[model samples]
Target: MSKRKGEISREKILSSAEYLFAANGYHGTTVSQIVREAGLTQAAFYLYFKSKEEILDEIFLNFERQLDQFVETGQQLNQHNFSEVEKHLTQTYIGLFQLFGANKNVIKIVFNEGGQGEKLRRRIVNQIHTNMTQNQSLGILKPEINTEVFAELLVASIERIAIRYGIDEDYSPAYLGHSLAGILFQGVLTKNT
Candidate 1:
């Protein structure tokens, strides 16, 4: 009973913190504000986490959990040609915003509302690195540049595309992801059938 209660309180704190940080960014949102908004005492807040940074790391990690899950699942998905990887990644990127709707809170926290260091970013990047490994093994990804750099660019492109389609409405993340993936694989020039 006590353990369940503690877990509930921690989740409450996390939920409140995710919303606050998502709306305000890491630096802008303070522990006091979180505690106040959560209706939990600072002592209770400290009981769950040592500091705000710890909370940020936890939320950042959790945020990636959903997106990461989709990517990881894609790798295992049985595709004969294996270009399905790109399709899966595009759906995942577009899904990120569509999953949260027009809220933009999650995007704001993860990208625009910045103050996050390389730590959280790299953890997410590490997933891409794993994909890079698979792509190289299968000869899908090129080895010209370092995998890290390429993965970084891939992540950035997806981020930009998501934001563009998410806010602008002129573009669609899903469609754009597929189009970009096709371009990457087939090149800019049209081929004669």
Candidate 2:
């Protein structure tokens, strides 16, 4: 019961922090604000997190873990051809959009407000570039393409596209997915056709 209570308290703190940070920006929010928002004492917040920066790291890492899962899943997908690749890529984009929507507040806080988000983005882009490098070596991605540049551009493009959809909920994920796939297909599809 205590364990469960602790878990609840921790999630509450994170939720409050997400809301507060999203609304006020990380720099604008304070520990007192988070504790008050969570309705928990500062001691409880301390028990779960060392500081506000720690909370940000936790939030960022949670998102990173989700991205890692997607990257692992992506490795098993679309190993054969461009059409299959486009299908898999589109589906992945849709999933990403859904994930972004679900964690909209945190996403807004991390991406829009300056802090650990930039570091996290760079780390994620690096991971993507490394994964692309592996794929190129395995001939799953075109060897002629520069994986570093490709990964950076791809991440930037997706982030830009996501921001557009994130602001307005009316955009269909499928349409965005197809549009993303179209752009990627034009850029990275090998000459196997």
lDDT score of model 2?
A: 0.80
Residue pairs in steric clash, candidate 2?
A: none
lDDT of 1 by residue, 1-47 (tens): 35797788898888788788877777788999998888899999999
How well does model 1 score by local distance difference test? 0.69
Worst 10 residues of 2 by lDDT: 71-80
* lDDT by residue for model 2 (1-193), tens: 2568889999999999999988998889999999999999999999999899988888888887887765554466446475576677778887777777788887887787665778878887888888788777777777799989998897888788778774467687677777787777775666795
Alpha-carbon local distance difference test for all models: 0.69, 0.80
Worst 10 residues of 1 by lDDT: 71-80
